[model samples]
Target: MADGAVSINMSAEECAIQALADRVMSQIADLFFAQHITPTPVQQQMLVSHVRAMALRSRTGEPLPEVEEALFEDISPDSMTLAQQVVDLFGNLPVEEAWLLSVHFEVAKNEG
Candidate 1:
C-alpha cells in the first residue's frame, strides 16, 4: 500500500490488516493508560514501530521463532492475553509472535 492511495484501491486483505494494526495500537494505548502506566515518548514510539513490524511479518506470513525461553517467565497472564488479542487481530498468526508481543509489553511495563 503506497502513500496517498485511496482506501477503495486497497485490496480487502490489505485493508483488514491495516484495520487490525490500527485497532491493536489504539487498544494498547487505552490499556496502558487504564493501568495507570505512563510510558515515555520514546517507549511509545518504539512500541508503535515494533507493532508495525510485527503486523508486517504476520500479514506476509513470515515466521519468528528465535526468541529465548527465559523470556516466557516474564510474561504475565494479563500481558499474554493482551498480546493474544493483538495477534488475533491479524488472523491466525504464529503463537511465537504473540509471545514476542508479550515480551514487548513486559519490557514496557518494567521500564520507567
Candidate 2:
C-alpha cells in the first residue's frame, strides 16, 4: 500500500484484478516518493479509483471510451512517460490508456 492506500471489497472471482490494481498503486507510490509528489487525499482517491478501473479494464479487455488527443496536449511529458510505464504492465492496453492515465498524474503533479 502507498501513501493514500485504499481498501476495495470485491468478490472472490475478482481478486486477481485487485492484486493488479494494488501493484499499480505500489508503483505509483514509488513514483510519488521518488519525485517528491504528495497528492491531496481527494486527488489520491481519484487516482486510486482510476487505477482500479484500469486493472479491471486490463483483465476484461474493456476499451477506453474515445478521448481527444488535444485533451492531453498540455500534459507533461514526464507524466505521460510514467503513465505509459504503468499501462505497459498490463501488456494489452491501448496507447490511449496511457493518455488517459497521464491525466491522473498530471493532476496530481499539479496539485501536489
Candidate 3:
C-alpha cells in the first residue's frame, strides 16, 4: 500500500456486476429523456429519494418502504412502451458517455 492509500482489487464477477449496475442506470436516464420527462426540480428530488431507498434496500436486503414503492410504481401506465424506448436509446449511447452517465445515476440513486 502507498503511504496513505489502501489498495483494493475486484474480481471479474464483481467488475461485471458493477458494469451491469452502470448499464441499468444509463438505461433509466435514457428512458427519462425519451419519455420527455424533463426532470423538474420535483422529479430530481424524487430521483434522489428513489435512489437512496434502492441503495438502502440493496445493502440491507430489506423490503422497500411503501412510500418508496410508489416511486417505482407504474406512473406512466405505459411503462412497457417507455421501457422499450429507453432500451433503444441506451443502445445508441457511446460507451464512455454511457459509463459516465451510469456513474451519475448510481450516485444519484444512492444519494438523491
On lDDT, the leading prediction is: 2
What is the per-residue lDDT of model 1 for residues 59-80, given as tens digits with 9 covering 90 to 100?
A: 7877776877576876898878
Residue 106 error, candidate 1, Å: 1.8
- How high is each candidate's TM-score? 0.69, 0.86, 0.38
lDDT of each: 0.76, 0.89, 0.45
Q: lDDT of candidate 1 vs native?
A: 0.76
lDDT per residue (tens digit) for residues 1-112 in model 2: 6778787877774998889999989988998899887889998999989899999999998888888888899999999999999889889999998999898888888877
Model 1 scores a TM of 0.69
Superposed model 1: Cα runs more than 4 Å off:
1-20
Model 3 segments more than 4 A misplaced: 1-25, 65-75, 79-112
Q: Tens digit of lDDT per residue, candidate 3, span 14-92? A: 5654555456556676766664545556656655454443433343456432333333333333543443333344343
Candidate with the larger lDDT of 2 and 3 = 2
Give residue 103's lDDT in candidate 1 (0 to 100): 70
